[model samples]
Target: MASALIMTGPLWFFTPIQVATTVIAGMNCGASTLQSPLTWPLLQDEAIPAQYSGKQTEWLLHGSEIIFPPFNGVCTVANLVMAAYCYYKRNDGLATSAIASAKLPYTALAFALHVATTVYTLTIMAPYNQKLKVASRKINASVEKGEEKSSATQQEGIREFRDAQAVWKARNYGRGAVMLAAAVANAVALKVSAGL
Candidate 1:
């Protein structure tokens, strides 16, 4: 997991940035492979029937929330700790030390990327998530009667649900882009520092 790699970023002092970047990039790649088409599309399909789609999406979002938050929280903590450690180590003596002098910039870059990813998730994804949760709760979960016309109010809720899902999916691409870039940057930093 990316969190584990980030947590260990400080430990890889000999090649911290390089290792961190490589590991985070690899994590991002793995996540991308799993999420796009594979996971999100399946979740989209699972929401059968116009009536239940919002609830299904809510369920899907909840499922994802359960998985994502804990890991992200851990990653956040790890990044913060590692960033501090990197700062301390850089200030202590690495600034003047020949081979280690380059670490400060790389370390800073990695930390900034990590922070950026967190910010992107919070500012961009979190609001949509909250809306989805609220909509799911407020919307009726029962199947609509086949003979009866869907109430205009019910239709509106369904539309809002679908719209939220669309918006969330669109914004997720941006988050993924940021993460991918972060991973790449981390990896590049590793290569620059470690020549690996």
Candidate 2:
């Protein structure tokens, strides 16, 4: 039962990251058309040559697309899996453990948060990608025209960044809650075992 919990916990947390990473990879494959200085806000300085600007934007976008998902996924998975193990061990003896009782509420809360985050990512973030694509096109065009393109990219970036941040925060909060609950459960289980 402990092992089962551990396995399920990690799987639940990491799956979202895996899916997000795949989506980013798909986006990067089509990013060649986004080769413009204005496509990325970080490289808008006049001192940077236009040629270098495009390359920088491409590199930054590619790196971000690859990195964020996997990093977030691994952290979340580890936290949840450890929590599951703790929770399971706490409840092994069941009847006399304060920790075991506490684990129930914590587990339920964490599970709910996880579900909410999943829904938001799928229903909201997935559709927002289309808007990002459109914004990318507009930014690229603005760059070609030697026009200031920060506004469009900034607006789009803000939206994407906010969505990503929310997902990440949700994962972190859920994981933390799970871990805390697990610790409490483990402590109670140990005490119960000692008394028995």
Candidate 3:
């Protein structure tokens, strides 16, 4: 003789909110980013030499310009939708404390992080991007004219541009870290939704 177990609910129990939350959170954590600025440095350092930096940087930067705005916008919208879903489920236990003295508003945290990234792009990256554009153009123009670095000023300008690019590269690590945190936050949100 064998015993059989009977289940009360359907085989699948995911509601619409839960499904949507899972989808968006899955995207945040598992998907690749739309931005490729980080990879440009590899090309700049290894494949492309300093002499070709102007043209390639200009090309890559323009490509980034075309892609990132809408991509980041979509990210913001996704975060908004996530926050809304989390909000609607607040009464379902999401609003409760996650740990001692700490409330786990995971979706809210994710949304704030994305907003901060946007603000950073606007305030910090924008000016630095402008500097890069100008430097690339100037270098290209000079190279095109076959002007060998004859003066201290020209050399200094090149050094400045190189330094600026280095700083931009370093800064992107911070950006990557922030976005990683956002993804982790969204992952937590997904976990919370499971219990609901």
Candidate 4:
């Protein structure tokens, strides 16, 4: 039993570092994206049509789509596993109660943040994303068929697209803040566990 516990110990030891690094990377990516001129170009040129503006915003956001899933996946899986293992070890007399208690709250906080980010994305951002996708498809199809650029329907689509992108960006910023907090908590967990 002692041998088994020692063998599996590194998972708890190293996973928090991975979680913290991934979260911080995600936060920086989001903050930089949000601050980019192309992200909110209205400050530069208010005259740009809503359609083009929306496309820029959508594409900028798409850049993050590739990175977020893997980051969140690793954080969620690793932290939850670590938390459970810590609890098990403590109960099994492999870890002392003080160390376990010290580590568990931070690990649990990181896990909760990961879950919160996912829930926020699904509940708050999904609808806007769906609207943005639909509007983008229609607008692209019309532009492809060489339709006149300023048709009333096209303008309406652009307006919808822009609105969705704006809301998504704002929600994404909130998600980024959550991720930042998770990173900090994970780092603190690592420090607490290091004494073990």
Candidate 5:
């Protein structure tokens, strides 16, 4: 019993980090997923208080904005820890692992998933975020102070702007899917690559 416990002792340190990594990935997925069911349509498309759509729009982005930056930071650390084991093997120590021989492949997959999501955020989503910011400013300006309705001339622009927001929302769902893939990858890594 003592010898067996000693043999598997390396697992103690790694298990928590792997679990944390998986959980963070899940939160990353949920951040984008939450917006899909309600925020875009009710708050953005047909805002209850149209002038207040600016506030609603900002609210929609707030939770994701909080999570998005730090998520990459955590993912970077997790990848490095996993990659270290992959590159520097401790054969016999963890040779019992199914993923021991697949060291490079598992680590490579984890890295790829993280990078893909980051690229999607920086390239695909950043532009839409900027556009939404600019449009929100324009929207606020269009609604004159104390006015219940916007200028009729600006209605067309607002319509187009809302359509843009809808497009952005749809695109965000794709990012959520990518994040989910990352979560699953990390979970598999957590399970099979523990001894790599």
Candidate 6:
């Protein structure tokens, strides 16, 4: 039980770190474009699109896109491992309490929620890229037309993006907390069942 708790608790920390690092990388990618006029056009107008222009932005968005499916797969595997562990402990003459039994269901629910969020995020990225492209074109055209205020409008959009990014960070941290709590609960239950 102690070993299980240690292992799973690290995953709780790890997932959040992965999520946060991805977000930071994404923001860096975006901010990088904003800072570099040369890259801005490429990111905003051409191949990638403006919304995904910055280093952090691109990294986060792409990482999320690529990593999420595998992450979900791993999560499913982890759930199975945890369920098996619980069963093994119980079969080894370990007393099972309601709390100990509940861990499997809770972990399963968390896994499902993680997968749902991943899918939702992936689906939204393309449309978001499209909207960003339109916005970037308009902003760039306005700037080309000698509209000084265009910069202000662009800044506003960037600010909003940063705000949204912060929200994502918060959500990620919250998910980490949930995982940590679940780990602790599972560990405690196991200890209690073992009279340790």
**All candidates: TM-score:** 0.69, 0.35, 0.68, 0.75, 0.80, 0.39
In order, the Cα lDDT scores of the candidates are 0.58, 0.42, 0.56, 0.66, 0.68, 0.44
Task: Report the error of model 2 at residue 3, Å.
Answer: 25
Off by over 4 Å in 4: 1-12, 15-38, 42-46, 49-55, 91-96
Winner on lDDT between 4 and 6 is: 4
Show model 2 residue runs off by greater than 4 Å: 1-68, 75-91, 94-97, 142-196
Sorted on TM-score, best first, the list reads: 5, 4, 1, 3, 6, 2
Clash number for model 1? 3
Where does candidate 3 stray beyond 4 Å? 1-51, 92-104, 151-154
Q: Judging by lDDT against the true structure, name the best candidate.
A: 5
| Alpha-carbon shift of residue 20 in model 2 (angstroms) | 21
User: 27-128, model 1: which lDDT tens digit per residue?
Assistant: 754574356456656545634654455666677667766765554444445445545665565555543243334544654565676677779878988898
- For model 4, how does the per-residue alpha-carbon lDDT over 51-105 read when each residue is reduced to its tens digit? 5665765675576566676677778777797777667655554445666666788
Residue range 1-196, candidate 3, lDDT tens digits: 0111101112122234334443544454333232336455564573454447756666766776676556555656766765665455445543232220121366568778777767876776667677777777666666667777664445655666677677766666566566677666655654554443
Q: Which residue pairs clash in candidate 1?
A: 18-190, 21-186, 21-187
Question: Cα miss at 5, model 1 (Å)?
Answer: 19
Model 5 vs. true fold: TM: 0.80
lDDT of 6 by residue, 1-196 (tens): 6445433542233234333333433343333223334432343343542334444454545555564455445544554565555444433433333333544454445445444544544454355533444554554555557656437776665555444443444344444443344343333333432332
Q: 182, model 5: CA deviation in Å? A: 0.4
Arrange candidates by lDDT, highest first: which order?
5, 4, 1, 3, 6, 2
